[model samples]
Target: MSAVLDIGSHKVVCLIGQQDSNMGVRIIGSGFGVSAGLKGGVVVDMDAAEVGIRTAVEKAERQAGMAIQSVSVNVSTRSLRSQQMEVHTEFASGEVADRDLTRVIESSLSELAQPEDAILHAIPLNFSVDGEDGIRDPRGMFGSKLGVDMHFVLAGIGPLRNLAHCVERCHLRIKSAHVSPYAAGLSVLTDDEKDLGVTVIDLGGGITTSAIFRDNRMVHVDAIPLGGQSITNDVARGLSTPMEAAERIKTIYGSALHGADDDYVNIPCPPMGAQDTLHHHPKSLLTSIVRSRTEEIFELLRDRMTDAGLDVYAGRRIVLTGGGAHLTGVREIAEQVFNKRVRIGRPNGVLGLPETIDGPDFAVATGILKAQFMDIDEAISGPPDLSGRRYRQRRYSGGPVGRSLQWLRDNF
Candidate 1:
């Protein structure tokens, strides 16, 4: 058995796996440990983060009874960006074979601009040749020229470097580090959602990450640097309670949408004095604090969606994942604001995991493990010198050229 470690701000997780024929990759073991030296999904300190990574890895290793060498980590930074690129090549033999297709696809990828940006993943979404469109597999398709549309997920260098250093310092080779949103999307997003359109929102403890998918690949993604912790803070400040108490209160009583009755739940309050005499209605105290902050986060998410031109989801849906996905009334709030169908998503393509980690908090870790089993590490060490090539740029028929209605239609 082999395993990979995911060092996150809230927790450090290890996913242990091995190859299987009938079931694909099977999960034999896993581990979780407290996290230190990580903030907003990036490694804030090397030594402490190394300790957390090693702790999780060793637990999984002990359980699976296998020595580990390398692992694939995840990066969930706010500075990440995504864009789709299309490259075309007239066939040398006026024929498109497997190798020729790969070449042209690589050529298009070579044209993408990632000078200061580190690519987390690049996946081909679709292929169009000549005037033909909607081709999923083009290996055997006959075409005079090959055109490929792909989605590239990129992250910042400092965040990636810090994460890599932490893993390496733990004596484990970093086989790869994928964008957390992409990883989460890979784990929770289904084929139909990806094919039609969907926005995957991962609400972690310290950060809220989002990925917009069209044509079954991630075309746009963004991360909000605030999360459930903010709610906890809001509760603490509003109620004038300790952070721990406020966190407990928020988890027990917080709701994104304001409700009608304040009698939904009763909560204990720390006494103003040393005596344990004071108590309050949990719902009453949460009056505007919890609801306001949560709504603000969703507003930020909507703004991000609008900024990325993903707000037009005529045929798309919103799929929420992560620890915050379980928050009360999130789907309801998102649907009301975005005015679209919304639902929560759980991890897919994994076996033998408890129903708890099966949720959104484990999305990225599960994706990294799945990528490792699929041997997608090569995709992480992407080509650095992508220069001097022609790519398909979006053009709007009636609107401005930068509007890209065709691109929007082709994707959404």
Candidate 2:
């Protein structure tokens, strides 16, 4: 059994499920709550965050008829960066073994041991044997030398510890803190898009993340502390309305691109205060406000990609996921800004999901569940592992927080 908990800036979702006989995840229970105490995906108030988490998980527990002791959560904190590590090593017997691959993978962590950083994921991007390149799995292959490219997802230690503290306060152990954008990519991207090269942009309530996937593995990840909530705020300030009214206006009229009929349409607006009378604005103005903010987001995404030396020059394909992806014209605007093929991505490869909750907004939660099933499949493929404690040591690096993180990983 597995529980996926997604704590975002605007919502907290808990999904409880298990793998069926056919190896597909069956979601038996789900819970959602209005998020509190989070800003830009960072926990700003532990007590408030814990309350929301507890409420969401409790709802899922009631539906599943089971109590969850721990959960796999998504890590969407700001300042999340990726560091690349490439290493070359020669096998003593000229044959690459599982142990040799493990050695090379571990060697890539030397640069990730900074005190202020916590490693969220250490992903092997590519492997090569001898002088040949692009070997997917090199184990059991005879080779004089092996090389590996690894990408490490690292976050500020302060934010991670705060997250851990918030989750702990809920009386639930942390299973694994997965990078939210990576999880979103896993849920929404097709195998072909991954192989041919595609960029996944996750637009959440408080953050927007971009991930580049090539050769079926993630190559880079970047995040901005801006998202759908920013658009809502923009609308509120532009229209001089309350946040609730602004949210309604944005959802009713928001668009990333302006349309021909927008100007002719008129919508009633609430009074700014008791002293002010009601008014009306052209729907075009509302769309324009949304357009400016959303355009800025895509432009920033393009600049970030350019700074990272990544471009759609290769395949020119982009997939948009997360809550903000649902906005009208977002895909079309992204296409114009990046000059690439763009589509909205929703969660797939899972079963028993209700239509109401089955969308890009739930991609991260679904991906967390899929990730757990993948781990189970890997463990079942080989001999049985020893015990949870031993597995933890193999999974997490040894450091001041190693033991604590080992406890966290063991709960998964």
Query: 282 in model 1: Cα distance from truth in Å?
Result: 5.6
| Candidate 1 to native Cα RMSD, angstroms | 7.9
Question: What is the C-alpha local distance difference test score of candidate 1?
Answer: 0.73
Q: Highest TM-score among the candidates is held by which one?
A: 2
Model 2 score (lDDT): 0.82
lDDT of 2 by residue, 76-181 (tens): 9777999887788665645677777766675565534565676777778778888787777898888768888778777887777777788888888887777888
User: Which 10 consecutive positions of candidate 2 have the poorest summed lDDT?
Assistant: 377-386
What's the lDDT for all of these models? 0.73, 0.82
Overlapping backbone residue pairs in candidate 2 total 0
Question: Ten consecutive residues with minimal summed lDDT in candidate 1?
Answer: 388-397
